[model samples]
Target: MRELACDVAIIGAGTAGIAAHGAATKAGARAVLIERGPGGTTCARVGCMPSKLLIEAARAAHDAREAQPFGVVAGEVRIDGRAVMQRVRALRDDFVASVFSGLDAIPEELRVTGTARFADPTTLIVDDHTRIAAGSVVVATGSSPSLPPPLRPVADRVLTTDTLFEIETLPESLAVLGAGAVGLEIAQAMTRLGVQVTLLDPAGSIGGIRDPKIAACAASLLGDEIDLKLGATVESAEAVGDGVRLTWRLESGGQETGTFSRVLAAAGRPPNLSGLDLAAAGIACDEDGLPDFNPRTLQCGTAPIFLAGDANHERPVLHEAQRQGWIAGGNAARFPQVEAPPPWPAYSLVFTDPQIAAIGQAFDAEEAHDWIIGETSFADQGRARAMDRAAGLIRVYAAPDGRLTGAAMIGPGVEHLSHMMVIAVQEGWHAATFLDRPFYHPTLEEGLQSAVKAVAERTGGTR
Candidate 1:
């Protein structure tokens, strides 16, 4: 067995791990980055990249099917799942390659690979064979799809997001368990590809984290094709012949059973910390495998050890993990006194057929700030009306003095719109500045002008 030494050791090479490695190395610490997998993130491999590609393809197919609405007559549109999957695989490979290539420039002293686990707070055991000693260690283990208790024993026909990507063929009918971002994104993507989909959620509404009005718009966009089974308690799940059976109790106290060619378990994600042996490292874990830590520093219960990303459990998103990892990595390398890290940025996005993005405090205007709310609907945007894609709204929360506090968008361009909101939230910019900036006319972005003006008007002035 070989022994290695490093100033800091970072386990896992996903978004957070990579960010930490970069920050640690830049901080003049000798860092060792390790991963059990040979390549880059699951996001690049199967999760975000491939899934989003498939969703974009599904959107194109949906547009073709609705050609008549655009005054363009076209023949029947059909998607070859095999071909689509092939393209997705190619894109996944390219993304992974790009990530790996970027890592090559990091100093040779700062990276290593193979399965790594804590032998002690400052010692990492690699591949169950080699041992590496370090001044500090940062854990960035990511998460895996959560399997529902009742469906745990079911086999084959039942799948999760991770398993679904490797499927040989798309099922004719799919029943998705959980109406969170994962379930809705996949369900809608599949529906556009001609698969009958049913979405089930325990909450009364879909997109639990989103504004209810935005979720209603999503429900409307899905039309009669996607079934909504809200406030349903799953009773049992079992495999029957080539399909699976699910019996659930509805919110009205009625029990119903349904069968589908495939059942997708998209019920959030559980942290990937089972093998890390937190006890040996003197780290404390909550019941859900999350580490006890300071939300600001991400330092675990013990010294010389920090946890970030999905393992820390504060929030789960690439951006959040990446930022937290940088803080943890820098703090671990610096060891004792250091400048205070920035407060965690709160933002989330759900990319369904109609995207929803939100950042900062919501529903806490009085507590967060003395405020005025500015709002605009997609219906008022020229580009939205011209594309016939208007199905949502944008709202900005501002202080009585016009300082922006929060921003949310639910409709086309929402993903891109979040960047502008991020700037406003980060800089504490005046909401009225958006109106004076002058966006190009005949575009969705011009809606920001309307939103800003509405907020200014409410705050006792018109921009």
Candidate 2:
């Protein structure tokens, strides 16, 4: 076999792997990036950008239909599914093109186009074409959507993020399984776009929300717009003529059935590590197949193997994935002297109406008895009332010493409001620091200020 050598070998060229290559090269290491398919990160192709495009279109339709409360008559709003999807695919192609421009710049000599399996701790064989010996390796193989076993029989009618966008026309009815971010966002968007949608989740929560109150508020608001089957397990799925028939059991042991033109299995995304012979490289894995690694350093045990992005099975979002990739690549360039990257506060946003935003740590009910709490409902907020869209909740948490701990919110514009809390947690800003700032009245900022003022009061700040 042909032979190649490098200081670092980065497997998979998704968002994380791309970042890894830059870090390794910047750290002055010879790095080879291997990818098995046409190069495009998941974000540009399916996850973030394209999905947001569809959501934006859905918002336009929903807004026009609901404008009567604002003393305006929009008459009739019609959804053109073909036109909507055409625009999504067209703009999605542009985003993929932009991403490819960067990938294309990588010199061919440093790029390997084949599947790679570990031959040893520091060696890889690429589809039997080339043997790569490297000082260290960074695995950023990313992940793929998982189809639940019960739904396997009707798999032909089931779609994943990987295949959802390829449909030429939107289905008249869709059954969305798993109410996590992906399921909720798609369910809401499709419902607004005039599709009959039913959202089912075994978790019994709307959007993986930690705060039960906010979760309930979100559920109530969204449940009005679509069928909600929380705490239900799919028992059987069958492909009927031109559609799917599904039977599921509720948490109370009651059975229900449904038929839909399409089924979206947004259940979960397991890492794409099936073919890589990790044990051959002396790396150990957990029962779930994630490597035993130091999260801060991104190093696999004490070995020179590093895990980054969704493959690590830690935080699967793009922002954290990109950050971990750089840290892993830099450490792989200087293996034995690996260093931990500086910590950043954790946060996540779900792009559902009455958006769900979680900042810093997820709230733990068992440990929250000692937390200083502050909250406000948008139903009474000025801007929300003025917009006729005020029907959600926001809550913040703090330590006794006044440090802003975290927040869980469900509100119309909480996606934008949550960033301030993200910065507050990241900078270790106290409640008093927030109270000291001037908040303009008749705005969402005023609502946030009210919560801040409550935190300040509880922490003994008179301001």
Candidate 3:
């Protein structure tokens, strides 16, 4: 077997792995990046970019169809399924091309092309050909679609975000399981594009939302567009003819059956840790196959190994993955002298119409009982009314000290509104702070401002 040595060895060349390599090198460590498959970040290939393309097309079709509210007369809108997929594929290729360029620029000698598994804690065997001994190793092997046990029989029929966008033409009908971000977004987009879509989730947790009000708001609004069957668990999934049939038991113990041309399992993506013989490396994984690691430093219990990205199984969002990757790689470079990265406040957005968003301390775990909640409705907001998109609510959660801790909303442009919310949470801005800021008239900011102002008034933040 070939022998090699490096300061840091990073498995997986996706977003997190790439960032990890950069940080490891920047920290003065000789780093090797390894990949087992075609090189490209998930965002560029399927997860984020291609999904957005499909959503944009759906938005255009939905807008034109719903334009009667704006008193605009329009002709019949026709969706060219072939053209839609073509554009998505073409643009997706452009994004992938850019990512590939970055991957290509990595020094050739440092790039290992094969699957890597732990021969020991600080040692890795790449496809049984090359043995690498490193000071530290980073497990950034990205996730793939984890099909539910019931769906395994009809695995080919049940698609996932990883395989969803690869369809050259839109299916006539699609049954999406798991009403979280991926399912909701895909189901809604497909529905708007003239496909028969039924969205179901056993947990009924829509958009990964923790705030009940916001979840209800999403359930109601999105329920109107698609056949949303929340709290339904699939008991039996079978391939029937050209479609798939699903028999699900509802939360109420009632059974319902549906058949569709495609079924997408968007419930979750477990980390890709199959071949990495972690046992040999003295790493212990929990019930979910995730190792104990410091979220801030990304170190695995002082074992000179780190977990980042979807592999960490914390937050699968691309930005968080990349953040964890960089930190993990840097720490791996300089083990024992590990330092946590500076903290940043939380922010996540779902690109559904009337975008859903949450910023910082969303569910309020141990401090739940202490949060002072303030809210405003978009039903009467001037800007939302003018735009004819007024149908949602915004809630801000503050500590007893009146500092803004988090905000949840399902409203027009919540994605844009999340930027300001993130800033407030990051800077530890109090309700009084927002009261001092300028909010223009006839704008979405005013609506958000009203919510913050309410929080300020509740906490005696009014000047």
The prediction achieving the highest TM-score against the true structure is 2
Q: What does candidate 1's lDDT look like per residue over 1-463, in tens digits?
A: 7788988899988888888888888899989888887657767876788889888888899889877878999898978988877787788789989988888887664567677878888888888667999999988988888878888768556788777877766788898999877788888899999888888888876665455555566666654457888888888988888898899999999999989999999888877888988888988776766777888888875488888887777788787888988988898788864335777447878788568777776655246446677888897688998888876888877878887777767778888777778777787777666666757778777776677778888765563
The digit string of per-residue lDDT tens for model 2 on 1-463 reads 8899999999999999999999999999999999997668889898999899999999999999999888898877889999999999999999999987898888888999899999998999999999999999999999999999999988888999999998998999999999999999999999999999999998878788988888899889989997999999999999889999999999998999999999999998999987899999998777888778899999988888999998987899999999999999999999889989666788889998878998986789988988888988888999999989888888898988888989999888887889888998998889988777777777887777788778888888746
| Models, CA RMSD each | 2.2, 1.1, 1.4
Q: Estimated TM-score per prediction?
A: 0.93, 0.98, 0.97
Model 1: what TM-score? 0.93
Better of 1 and 3 by lDDT: 3
- Where in model 1 is the C-alpha error above 4 Å? 105-112, 223-225, 364-371
Report the C-alpha lDDT of model 3 over 1-463, residue by residue, as the tens digit: 9899999999999999999999999999999999988778888897899999999999999999989987898899999998999999999999999998988888898999999999899999999888999999999999887788889999978788888878889999998988878888899999999999998888866888998889888889988898988889998888899999999999999999998999999988888986898989998988877788888988888799999998887888898988988889889898978989775777788989979998998775567678888899999999999999999999999998889999999999888888899899988999998779888787998888888888888789977
Clashes of 1: 0
Candidate lDDT values, in order: 0.79, 0.90, 0.89
Error of 3 at 307 (Å): 0.8
Provide the clashing-pair count of each candidate structure: 0, 0, 0
Clash-forming residue pairs, model 1: none
